[model samples]
Structures are given as structure tokens and as C-alpha cells.
Target: MSKRTAILQTAAANTDAATEALDLALAMASMDQSVQLILASEAVNCISDNPSKRYAMLELLEAEPILVFTDEPLSNPHQLDIEIISSQQLAPQLNSYNEVLQFS
Candidate 1:
């Protein structure tokens, strides 16, 4: 069975790390690896209205479902669409992955 991967994106919006994390996730997903893209803290900004082509390409790749760890969804000024997960869910969810790549 393919190993499950959790790509934890911790970079702030518009930063290179954020894009790199997405690119890495995309690459892994293309290889038929099970991938979960999780955005943490300010990295959540990378999801929406950001000036990154990768965000649009996210739909082209079957990498989801993307997840966000937060008590409540933010105002979402940037607007990358994904599920909002509670803190309690984060640990169990991350533990489910076979590997985790955190991009700070």
C-alpha cells in the first residue's frame, strides 16, 4: 500500500516555503502517493487570493482534501478553500499519516 503523506505548510503567505511545500505536495501526489496538505497558522494565507500559480494548480492535482488547523475559520481574506479542523483533530489526523513534511 502507498504510504500516506501529510505536507504540513507552515510558511506565511506569499513566501517561498509555502509555494515550495505546495510544489512538493503536488509532486508527491502526481506519483500516486496519498497526500494531505495541511496549512498551519499564518500559512493558511497561502490558500487564497495569493499570487501563486500553484494555488490554482492545486485543483489540477488530486492532492486533497486540504486541511486547516484552527479553532474557528479565519475571516479568510486570502480565500484558499479547504476544511477547517479543530486543534483536537490535528494530532489524530497527523498521526494517521505515514510521513510528514513540514515546510516552515
Candidate 2:
């Protein structure tokens, strides 16, 4: 079995890096590779603010998305299943993945 992957999206959703991260996750998921996304810092904006575009992108994908936040309640118009975690929990969580792709 292929190693599970955790993609770290640290850039704001408007940037190319964020888009690339999502693309990579989608591609990997389509190939049957286990994939997950880690949204840290500004990357959480992808779903927390003006989420329509981001929600559309995620609608067809099968990867689990995780959000790492500190002192900010998360809200979204979309119903995507998201795993929320604290910033302090990020280190150990990321360490649990066998592979990590970062778009920071």
C-alpha cells in the first residue's frame, strides 16, 4: 500500500500555491492514493471565507480536509466534513502522516 499523504496548505487561497495544493490532492485522490489536506494559518481562508469556490473544488474530491486554528471559531456555508485541530496539535498530527506535501 502507498503511504498516506498529508498535504499542507499554508498559503492564502487566492495564491497559486494554494490552488496547486488542492490540485495535487485531487490528483492523488483520483489515483487511489490516500490523501488529506492540512489547512494552517491563512490557508483556512479557502473554506472559512467566501467558500463557494473552494467548496465547489472540494465537492468532487475524496480527501479529508483538516483545519489548524488558534483562537478562531470556524464557520462555513458548505457541508464538507472537516477535522478541526488546534495549532498546538499540528506538529504531532503532521508527524503521523507518512508523506507530507507542503505549499507554503
Candidate 3:
């Protein structure tokens, strides 16, 4: 059987929501699921200079693939070491995935 791929889109505006989104993604990844996390719009703010949040996300990145859409430039001072894909690439990327989950 083919591995199931999942894309998790997050537009969380606050820390709590962002944390919850991260938790969900972690859970999915822990189950040996192919999970991709996309940070868009305000969701990019979740990876600010804050150590705890950044570290949490870094842990998740170690477990699964994390991506950011180029259309939404990150507003945070801290940069996340993840792949940045263009809007044009979004459709094709999603096409390769079996499921897409959005958390706003």
C-alpha cells in the first residue's frame, strides 16, 4: 500500500491555536503518517523568536515535512529552517497528498 500523505494548513493567529495545530500535526506524524505542515498568512507568526514555540515546531519538523507558502512572507524575526514553496507549486504539491487539513 502507498503511504498516505497529509497536508496541514495552519492560519492560527494566536499562540494557543498555533500550539493546538502543532499538537495535532505531531499526533498525526507520530502515527507514522506522512504529514506536511504549511504555515500561511498569520500562521507564520507562530514561529516567532519565542524559544518554546520555535523549539516545539523544530521538533515537529524533525518528525515530518514542514513548508511555507511564498505568497505569505514571514513576519517573524526568527526564521524557520523549512522549505518554501510558491503559490504555483501549491496545487501540484497538494495533488501528491491523499488528504489536506486546515487549521485556522
Off by over 4 Å in 3: 13-17, 48-61, 72-79
Instruction: Pick the lDDT winner.
Output: 1
From the highest TM-score down, the ranking of the candidates is 2, 1, 3
Per-residue lDDT, model 3, residue 61, is: 49
Best of the two (1, 3) by lDDT: 1
**Model 2: CA > 4 A from native:** 52-60
Candidate 1 residue spans exceeding 4 A from truth:
48-51, 75-81
Winner on TM-score (1 vs 2)? 2
Per candidate, the number of residue pairs that clash is: 3, 0, 0
Candidate 2 residue lDDT tens string, 10-99: 999889998898888778877877888788888887777775354354446665655545458888667666778887888888888899
Tens-digit lDDT string for candidate 1 (1-104) = 77899999988977788878888888887787788889888886665434466664555677677788878546656455578898899999999989999999
